[model samples]
Target: MKNKKEMAKEIIALVGGESNIDSLIHCATRLRFTLKDQSVAQKSELGKLPGVLTVVETAGQFQVVVGNTVGEIYKEIMEQTSLGEGESSDKGSRRSKGSFLEKAIDVVSSIFSPIIGVLAGAGIIKGILLILTQLELLQKTTGTYQILNAASDSVFYFLPVVLAITAAKKFGANQMVSVIVGLSLLYPGLVTFMASGEPITFLSIPVLSGTYASTVIPSILAVWVLSHLERLLTRIIPDVLKLLLVPAISLSVIVPLTLLIFGPFGIYVGNGVSSLYNSMYELSPLIAGLFVGGGWTILVMFGLHKVLVPIGLNDIATLGSTTIFAFAAPANLAQSGAALAVAVKLKNKEMKSVATTASLAASLGITEPAIYGFNLKYKLPMIVAVISA
Candidate 1:
């Protein structure tokens, strides 16, 4: 295989050179690029690259699918270019102005993508710790176990702060000020007061008491508001005092509003979305299972699959476990099994090799390579995979 640096250079050249790129970021799997001229990138050529699994264009990004090695590729890509500034404006871009759903997906994906690895790691540790404690292999009361448990829980506990910083970047808000707001949510005094169960009142209006830790919606919504407020403050505040006043004024206005309005509103929104999903699942477990299982790959094809991540995470945060990801387990099995079948039947050596590798990758729970690289290329296999799912 080519070194990552070489692959990065080739990929860069294929994506209309470095100059066409407005911003570049990598999720767990794909290298997401916001290009100045989308038309200039050679999508097909990029997909044909040795290390690349496929190329996907959706959610306002020229997404190059590199599978799990995307982080290493991203590092190489960064080293090769000066596109690390992370300027995400669409100024002079050819893509249409995004709809609300599109914008929301972009924001959500951007915020979650970078931190997902850490989140998953923390979750794994928590799961392992739970299992060990239940089995009596590890005593939960031990100092070692407590320290490890804290490590596992820290990510969720500080989720709002991380989300604040990431969302601020995505929404063009002041990052530090947004972080300050996030920090305020978890302030020791506030936590203490909240734990006391005493009523909180601002201007004689009672504050709804809720823990912001491990919640997704509140910080994201808060940052979205902060982005708009920052823009307004920047325009009105004088140049000399602009930096100082903008952050101060934005925080002063937003922090109170977040505690009073946005925080509870976001929780309500999460509950509503969760409720709708639960209602759907309850209405027809079989059909819902079939639809999610059968069309899982199709959803990923259109970039709609990411909508489930937050839902699943939210469910875990609120309800301790999720039903959503259960459907995906079967989907992965069906697709990988089909890919393996195709690999066994294929005549071409190259096709057979790719199919075999993709099949193994899919069985290991990374299905993009198999789905995009093997199944989709031979339409019959992809169809059979969906049917089998």
Candidate 2:
């Protein structure tokens, strides 16, 4: 196998060198690049690299699949090239523009990718705590239980604040100002005031009463608006006064706007989507199950699966659970089973090794290696996996 540096170097060259890259980021298993000229990228050659699993071009990204080592590989690429981590020197002007759906997926994936690992860890802790309490192994009234519960719940409780930092990065807005916008939504005083059952107003405009903790859409929408407001402020405000006025003006304007408009609007949108999904599920569980089970991997292939994360998160926040993961779990495990079958029957040593490792990863709920590196490569396995799922 090639070393990380060598692999990174080869990848940079194959993607039309450093100059062609407009920006770069990575998810759990792929190096996603936005290129200035997609035609110049050597996609087939990138797939042939030793460490590379495959290459996929979707959602206006040239994605190089490299399994779990994607983070380290991304680090090596950043170290060896001029490309900034998740930021472009060109400010995205030269990058390929995708359709509205593609742009939405790109934005959602980029905002969530950096935080998914910690969110999953917190979720696991919560699950374990729940199990312990259910089994009578731990008392919810104990100090230890209280501390652990806080640790697990903090992520969700402060989700809007965390999402603000990431959404600011994705939208190229002022991070601190974005954080302030998120914080205002969850401020203790405001929470108390809103919960008081009295009317709330900002400069005579009525503010909607709603909870923002553990919610997803409001922070993102707020930061997206902040990005544009910052740009306008930057242009109109003098350089000498920018440092002082920009943040102050942004917060003063955005906080009220978020309270009066974005926060309520986002909550409504989230509730509407959740209700729509529930109605679909209520209409026919078997059909919904069949489609999500069979087509979830297909959505992943096109990078559209990320579009569902917010919906699932919103459902969890509102409804306490979601059906998406319930259906997806079977699809993932089925792919693992199919890959194991391929591993057992394959005569070629190299292909067999890939299948074996990919199968193990898929069983642990990381199915990209299995889907792209094994099952999808062998058409029969993929078809069988989809049917079985």
Candidate lDDT scores, in order, read 0.81, 0.86
lDDT of 2 by residue, 1-389 (tens): 89898999999999999988877888778898988888999998888899888888888888998998999999999999867754521242242477987776788888887877777778879989999999999999999999999998998889999999988877788888888898998999999999999998877888889999989999999998888888888889999999999999999989888888898899999999989888888999888888788888888777667777788889888888999777877888999999999999999998899889899988767788998887898899999998988
Q: Score residue 312 of candidate 2 by CA lDDT.
A: 82
Taking all chains together, each candidate's TM-score versus the true structure is 0.88, 0.94
Q: TM-score for model 1?
A: 0.88
Best by lDDT: 2
Worst 10 contiguous positions by lDDT, candidate 2: 86-95
